[model samples]
Target: MPLNKKLAEKLNKRFAPDSRLDDTYQGLDLTYITNELGEPITLFIGKRRPDGAITGERYVRTIKRVPNSDQIASSHWDLKGKVSRS
Candidate 1:
């Protein structure tokens, strides 16, 4: 499901400085680490294959937060290529 605006806001506030989200799959997992604004953050975790190879490991993309309705509307448009798509 799509994340709600209120929930997004809450997450933003909760993870503002030193909090994050974690997800797991089998023996693999991902952690969204915190970082300074405009700086790149790293994601760590994933499973190794039978041959000791790893897959599905990746970094979480940094997204600049929009703190106002106008920015949020613009972001929505950018994401969907139009405001009415959602």
Candidate 2:
């Protein structure tokens, strides 16, 4: 065995978006929007929970400019981050 994953290596799958937006836990909302200068910025809008096992919810979005239309797309639970449950 080569002890390596060729598919992962080929695609450079080093990181993936978060997937923890289930209904079991109440979570904060996320917004990816263009700033005043037309630059994209990611924002997490909410207070962190103080509980040990409390998890937060969020979404990721990007502003794409189509030929004749500007589309704002989003994917829920796409924020990759770690929370210390301690």
Candidate 3:
């Protein structure tokens, strides 16, 4: 199944990115993570097409976290040919 609106909203709030759709995978397929409990987790934003289409299948390549990592006030995203960290 494809990512849904509720899950997308949750990821959006967590990242609260200036733009929600900014990558290239979601359009082609679904990407995601499942927690230890086996629940799906979204670690990145969706992709936005030039035509203004918002898709929930996109994702980040290396979603990692370190304790006390350089205090990022907000989540981030970057796309340079491929989606990556900001």
Tens digits of per-residue lDDT for model 2 on 24-64?
11344322333443333333334445432333323243445
Q: Assess candidate 3 and give its lDDT.
A: 0.40
Please give the lDDT score for candidate 2: 0.33
The Cα error of candidate 2 at residue 35, in Å, is 2.7
Positional deviation of residue 66's Cα in model 2 after best superposition, in angstroms: 2.1
In angstroms, the error of model 1 at 21 is 7.4
Off by over 4 Å in 2: 1-34, 37-41, 45-59, 68-77, 83-86
Q: What digit string (tens of lDDT, one per residue) describes model 1 on residues 1-86?
A: 23346523333432444545564544554455565432224444455445433354444433545675313222221111111111
> What are the RMSDs of all candidates, in order?
10.6, 12.6, 11.8
Off by over 4 Å in 3: 1-27, 43-86
Q: Worst 10-residue stretch by lDDT in candidate 2?
A: 7-16
Off by over 4 Å in 1: 1-13, 19-23, 36-40, 48-56, 67-86
Candidate structures ordered by TM-score, highest first: 1, 2, 3
TM-score, candidate number 3: 0.24
lDDT of each: 0.39, 0.33, 0.40
